[model samples]
Target: MNPVATWRRLLAEFAGTALLVTAVVGSGVMATTLSPDDVGLQLLENSVATAFALGALILTFGPVSGAHFNPVVSAADWFLGRRAGTGLTAGDLGGYALAQTLGAIAGSILANLMFDLAAVDFSGRDRSAGHLWLGEVVATAGLILLIFALARSGRSAVAPAAVGAYIGAAYWFTSSTSFANPAVTIGRAFTDTFAGIAPASVPGFVVAQLVGLAAGAALTLALYPGVGQAADEVVVAHDGGTAPTHAGRP
Candidate 1:
């Protein structure tokens, strides 16, 4: 890829992740404020907003950056690609991760500013719990499975909706409200709100996410044996009207 193209891709990843965290944190704060008396309603509002935002972001940025808004997702993509000799380059992986982490922190600050709070407040909310960790595993596993499977089957078009819906549902079903993304988890730490997690709780959530990533990858390979290699293909029209799948970036 051209150097300019690589930088553009990295920039897209950074901007995409920042906007995602903005939605997650901003919605959580607004929902909590609006539904002070009802935790359930707050979560519902937050999840709905997040789901819709996620779908829009992916659809908008997928072609440019694969729309990886999470640290685990970025790492997984690089791993899968390298394994198949067709994914992101090593330099791109590191750049993506760095950009995502920085964007997440910036997003948290932005959300706080929007809500008339300190720009960077360390959360005191105690979210460390065994059940929560388990939830992270389940949430992340489902997410990875969905994305990779979509890519494998050439149904990447539906990923925006599918991923968004899965995440929204996971918020209700999972014990931790599905903080499946490490970048999101870290970003939420800067706010002491309904969506915030204490700095101490972050490590456990990250660990669980990593475990889930591994489990999801294993499951993907087992379910779709050639997914790693075929996931980067695109269907192209030839001289005739027929469209054939060929190896390309997802």
Candidate 2:
């Protein structure tokens, strides 16, 4: 890709990630504020807002940056490009990852500001444990399998809805509330609110997500053999630039 186009894509990733974390943290604060005593109610509110916000964001940004607000998704896209030779370059991967992480942090800060809180307080909620890690693995693995499988099966068009629905469901089913994206996990650490995770816990979640990424890659091969995106389809790049053919699922 040309330098200009690379920067364009990175900008999209950054903006998309910022908006996503804004939704996550903002809605979390809203939910907790509205339902201070009812954990279930808070989860319900957060999940609904997240699902709707995610679906809208994907549709809005997919064309620009593959909507890959998640670092693992970028990694997966890069790995596929390396193997199949039709996706992101290494530079693109690194840039996208960095943009997404920074965007997420910005989003978190924005959320805090909106809610009249300290903008950069670290979370105290310790989410480290075998169960939480297992949940992360399960949540991330399912996300990978769902996204790539959709791309392989020529269903990337439905990813906006499908991916959102999956994450919403995963929120309730998974123990860790489906912090499937490493960038989001890191971003969540910046806020000590209902949606926040302690900085200490971010590394563990990131590691589990990576392990899940590997597992999902293996599963994609075993389950959907020889699934490649069609030429007419693109994951991101609103300018009609080509990105790896995958579900621009974040």
Candidate 3:
């Protein structure tokens, strides 16, 4: 991949992830402040709204950047051969990871400002140990399975919708409320909003997500055999040696 294209893709990931977390946490804050007695309903509403927002954002940006709003997803894409290995080099991973982390923080700050919920405390509020770990595994596995299915089926065009819907559903099905992205989880730590997770607990959540992703990838490899190679088609360069156009499959 061209260096310039790599930079553009990284920038797109930064912008897209910022918008995703902003919409998710921002809506959570809104739901909490506006709802009367049903906090569960509020969380459901916020999660669904975030899912739709994420779908639209991915639809708009996936062609340019692969719409990897999460580090686990990026790492999985690398493992599946869908990313330009050269573009996701150590330096590139550092840049993307930093951008994602900062973007989540910015999103949280924005959500707090918008909802005037800055006074809420965020420490020691996250679910941990026992049931939470199992929930994380289920949610993360669901997310990766959705991604693998869509990408493998050559339906990359609709991957955003599929992924978004899976997340929305996972919110209801999982006990820990589906924290599928590490960057998003960490960013939520700074806020006392509806989606907030305690900072001290983020490492455990992240580790669980990674484990879930690994399990999901292994399952996909076993079930589909050649699916990883098929999904890899999405990011390959084109005939002219330049990065392929949005309309072209790799």
Measured on C-alpha atoms, candidate 1 has an lDDT of 0.79
Residue-by-residue lDDT tens digits, candidate 3, 1-250:
3334767777877788878878988888778768858888898889889889988988766666667778877666666654434324455566667777777777777777777666334645766776887898888877877776556656666676778888888888888889878888888887866788888789889999999889887877776555545443332221222322233232
lDDT of 1 by residue, 1-250 (tens): 2123777767877888888888998999999789899989999999999999999988777767677888777677767767677556678778988888888888889989999999999999988999999999999998888888777666677777888999999999999999899888898998887888999999999999999999987887788777666434211111112222432423
Question: TM-score per candidate, in order?
Answer: 0.91, 0.91, 0.85
Weakest 10 consecutive residues, lDDT, candidate 1? 234-243
| Candidate with the greatest lDDT versus the true structure | 2
Model 2 segments beyond 4 Å from truth? 1-4, 228-250
Residue pairs with colliding backbones in model 1 are 81-87
All candidates' lDDT scores?
0.79, 0.82, 0.71
Model 2 per-residue lDDT tens digits across residues 1-250: 2233677778888998899889989999999888899999999999999998998988888876678788888777667546555456788888989999999999999999999999999999999999999999999999988887776656667778888999999999999999999999999999999999999999999999999999987787687655433212324333443433443332
Error of 3 at 135 (Å): 0.8
**Candidate 1: residue 240 Cα off by (Å):** 20
Q: Which stretches of candidate 1 lie over 4 Å from their true place?
A: 1-4, 231-250
Query: Candidate 3's C-alpha lDDT?
Result: 0.71
Q: Sort every candidate by TM-score, greatest first.
A: 2, 1, 3
